[model samples]
Target: MSNKLFCEGRWTEAIAQYQKLLEIQLGDADIYYNLSYCYRQLNLLDEYFQALQQAIKLYPQEGKLHFSLIIDLRRNGRIQEAILNAENAAKCLPNDYTFKILKYLTVPSIYENQEEINFYRQRFIQGLQNLIQQTYLKTKEEQQSALAGIGRLTNFYLSYQAQNDIDLQRQYAKLVHEIMAANYPQWVVSLSMPKLQPNQKIRIGYASHYLHSYSGTLWLTGWLRYCDRQNFEIYCYYTGNEPDPVTQQFQNYSDIFHHIPYNLSAVCEQIIADKLHILVFPEIGMDAQTMQMAGLRLAPLQCVAWGHPVTTGLPTIDYFLSSELMEAENAQEHYSEKLIRLPNIGVSYPKPYIPPVVKTRSDFGLEDDAVIYLCCQAPSKYLPQYDFIFAEIACRLPEAKFVFLRGTLLEPRLKRAFAAVGLNSEDYCVLLNIPERLDYLMINLLSDVYLDTFTWSGGNTTLEAIACNLPIVTCPGEFMRGRHSDSFLKMLGVTDTIAENETEYIEIAVKLGLDLAWRRTIAERMSQNHDRLFDDKACVEGLESFYKEVCSKHFSA
Candidate 1:
């Protein structure tokens, strides 16, 4: 009966039926699991936890249930417990590689025991090497059969590690290509087409899942809006079918806009049917389907911009379009794609919409006189080592309160991280989930200084901070992913807050927090220099020139 309700998509009715079944006979573990699913779908986390716990208790040997609980624990910021659960699952199913991969992926998030983490890291590397060896030694057919799961695990490993090392990043990316070559060896597609007229518009297509008010959407919207429409015919292929005002605006600018509701193959077919001379992905690696499609040869010239800001590691990707200012001196050595640097901050950015500051410091429980330093990047962007930087800043500015946007599931981990560095929870605060964009902007406006994350720096958030005229203090790291705000600040002509190293990062943040006059000077400069960074027309022209060069080279070949 509960199954009937569940199949009919009646989650509340299914919960009721499950409750009735539990009242009559409570020993059935499957019933409890079903109830947990219903509660999870309904967003009743407490009830979901209770039901899942009961299910696990009733069926301790069920690996699938254990895995589900492990995911739940990890999602709720219980990383250590999640690792332990994965250990138990691995013990229960020794042959399964999933649990081992889970344990490996959770290692970076664990900051308490460095020695234990080192041990697990070594074990994971050794296990991965062994898997790669075994998989490579297999026949083509066997490798294809095993590549699906192995490919996914390798991608996860690369995603986490890309924030850390470039050499290891290259290795993991090569492993992905190896898997793809084994599975889909015929990636290149041959095209027989007519030559373009003397002044035909270059057909270009931009594809992604984020076509709304998101990181990629915001970064590429200006390009779509201000591109040389006469010389470049643009097509937008959005996988996310949901349409908002931004989506409608993109449609208004694009010559052809497609909201792809079909599968990956169908989406690929649509692109091929368009016969685009060039295809661009604003970002890759955030979605599995996008990554898979990216691994295929889709167009004559394929390039990726700093949307996700990492090496794609696919041979089909021809160019890594990066900013001239943000990348390090040795940036090209890190990317698998051929590096192409664009002047200024690369793509044209949408003009920031500064909503009215509706809330006050007092309304948010912040003291009127205290210096507030805001670090609103998502939690996963934070590396465990950067806790010391925050601690040092808090220590230097005793009256300063560090603020972070909440709901990133890093509250407990952050508390532990700060405690390890001798800073108490009282030294910082996490602002609760702000649902409205205006409220988020208000928080940025209310804050004194913006602190960027160390490795995976904030992209859209950095622009929003600039929009609010908030002075950002950034410690640019070794990779392009960590340099978005660095580039933005440079483009804004405010390099005083861009720190050179970790020590300088702490000193700069502390100086900005304690020194009122200097901080205000930087803020005023940022406000005055917004035009340098917000010049969408110039950026679009640069992009148009690059597209024309790529098209000319392709057709000439």
Candidate 2:
């Protein structure tokens, strides 16, 4: 009965059946394993862990069970335990490439400090090397599994790299695309496009898994809302499961909105049926189905923008639409697609609706006089090497407090990162609860200075800071992802806070934190220049111009 229920995909019913079977025969490892699978499917994480633990205990040498437990542990935020189990799983299943790859995926979430990050990063590279070496021996089925795993999340690989190497990033992205292409070769071949009818509104489709209040939503909403409805008919193909007010708002602005079903083949067929002249995937690498579709000729012209800000590495993608200010002169060479540099800072953002600050500094237990430097980027954005900057800032300003928002799961790693530079987490940094959007904005408004992450810089947060008229001190790196704040600051005509080097980054952060007059003047200037950055209509106009150029080229071809 349990097996039947599991086979039918009724995971909740399967769990109940498994529990009944378990009550009858308590020591069955297979039952526990099946129970764990059911628990995992239902996302009852604690139950999943317990069942997996029991399964692992009963079947000590079972490599697959250990693998399942590793995932569960990580998912449940048992970071240290997850790492230990991953290592154990690798030892138990020395030849299994999945276990080895899983180790690299889990390691970055919980680094101790610079040394550990460096050590694991090297191990990850070595693991990739090993994965490539063993690929030749695998069966056709196993090879497909390995290829499917490769592009599951390329963001992990991009983030794991010690430094920003655009070449290597391109390589990683290209490899993933190749794997995906190999699996779906039909998608790689260009479809025959019909000539566009004169005077017909060009249908522009935006594809993404995040159509809610996510970064992709935030990045594209302004353009969607303000796009020239007369010339361009906008269609939003949202693939996310969660639908919120933001999703509804996007639907309201769009000529047509589709909640794309999960079936990949069906999704492709639906998109093709729409006969879209152009399709723009705001984010690709993050979603498997979206990335797969992106590898296809769903439209005459398919382009990608900087929702996640990494290369698609797919041949089918025509242009990588980017901001003129954000990208360097040689940025075109880094992308797989033809680079389209839009005038201004690229997309115009909607003006932020600043909610009343319902809560005070005392509510968050922040000291009244402390110079709070908020480093609120996700824990993954934090490279261990950047910990020194925080330490230096704390040292220079004794009354300083660094607030690292979220990543309670990454506490062990974060503590170690800070501890490496002789700064304790308690003394230097405060971990705050991930507040609601309005509260987060309020926190940004209240904070003294925003310290932008080096590698994967803040995108939406940078815009939010600018909206709140808060001062941000940024250190732009080699990649486009690191240059968001730099672009925004430059666009806002405020360059004093743009740090050229790590030394400058530290100097600027300290200067802003200490000098009240200088900081106030910059903040005031930011408020004055907010209109320059929040030109949503201008962004739409620029985007429409680009679209016209691309569509014209497509039609002429």
Candidate 3:
């Protein structure tokens, strides 16, 4: 009864049934697991943890109980406990298929910290080497199993190296493609969605995991608010566990708002049942839940936007929301999705909190005479080319220091990349435990110039830097990450700072460092031009007009 109730989406009743079962049998592990599932469904964090702990304690030898606990711990950002539980679970069911899956899920956290990443990378490499040695001694079936395990381990290690090493990403992508073709061929083709009527009101669906506090959601909120109500209906599909105050505000703008937790198939079916004409995937590869949803064709027109600038490489994704500034002459040829350009500076919305001015360099731990060069790019954006460029700038400016905000997963690799480029540890700093987004913005104000990363540009970071009256020097590259800074700089009327190549990039950095007057002039203008770059009203008008044009074409066809 509890399982049936849970499947039927009656989670509260499911919890009641589980509670009754637990009362009759105090040591029922399955009942405790069901209760934990129900609590997780209702976003009752404490109850979920308590129930999961009870389930694990009752069924200490069960792999599934430990797996569930590991998942919950990781989701709640309890990394240390998750790692320990994963290790224990691996020991409990050494040869089980579920154990392999649980181990895969837990391995990423081993690379969450700097020291852990290096340690795991070496451990994985050594394990693969040992497996190769054992293959010669084993039977054919055993050898094949060992090779498969090694393949999976290689993919995990490659994903960790992808940020700082492009060669590794390419090599891993090839290996994964080969392995999938040989092992799981069914995952290749794109899933098709329901057909749509031309005259019907276009039902646009927005999908995201961070529909709560993320900056990408801020842009999406404005787009939904300004949608043409007469011609279109907006549907929001959120995969997040908890809904914040902003998420509640976003709910008010949607025709239908549904939180389908962890059920990708049901979420896709729900959107298809509603006859959604357009499905917008705001986050591409960031969240597993969001990525799984994008793999299914939930609507007739599946689109991706600002959240992830990379090509999703999924055939189900039909279009990429882009702009002239970001999508260069050859972008359409490179990316898998059809390009749809927005009229203005791509997709951006105004942030609710504005940062206050910092009085001095002492505020953020910097010398008054130091020329602070800030790169607030997320750790994944720190490519080899970016390291080379920054090294050149540091070499040219002896008094300059580089500062970065470390991501939860990539801090160690980031520090290593900086060191590899001849930058001293003292010349770099990483700020931790920042309580709010506004605090991050205030720190940007203390910098002299904000340098944009290559390959992948800073999106929200660039906008926030401008908002804090910091001048940004960007050299636009090929894809989404490369072009974001270009679009924002153009929108803010500060295109002179954009460079073309290595020489120009270094020159631009030096100029920004040496010419204080020019830097101040650009910063002052950028501060005044925030209205044009982040105005919600203008963004809405442009989006609504584009929607009308697309609707007209669809109807006429």
State the C-alpha lDDT per candidate. Answer: 0.74, 0.76, 0.66
- Could you estimate the TM-score for every candidate? 0.84, 0.83, 0.67
lDDT of 1 at 551: 70
Off by over 4 Å in 3: 1-200, 358-360, 407-423, 427-433, 536-557
| The 10-residue segment with the lowest total lDDT in model 3 | 151-160
Per-residue lDDT of 9-37 in model 1, one digit per residue for the tens?
Answer: 89999999888887887646777777888
lDDT of 3 by residue, 263-352 (tens): 655676687677776788886656655654565556656788867666566666777787766777766765566777776766656654
Cα lDDT tens digits for candidate 2, 1-557: 88999989999998888887778876567778888888877768888888887787778777668867876576555667887887777777665646656765455454446787677666656665664455543356655665555524344434534364445445445555555566666666666565667877989999888888787557588888778877988988887688988899889989989897566666777778888888999876777667767766788889998886777767778888888888987887667788888777678677777876687787788988999998788766777667678777877898898887875655665566668767776777788986577678878878999989886788888888888778999978787887888998988899999988999999999999889999999999999988888854666677899898877876777
Q: What is the C-alpha RMSD of each candidate to the true structure, in Å?
A: 4.1, 5.0, 9.9
The candidate scoring highest on TM-score is 1
Quick one: best lDDT, which candidate? 2
In Å, residue 8's CA in model 3 sits off its true spot by 33
| Candidate 2 residue spans exceeding 4 A from truth | 1-51, 56-68, 72-107, 110-157, 160-185, 407-424
Q: Which of candidates 1 and 3 is the stronger one according to TM-score?
A: 1
* TM-score, candidate number 3: 0.67
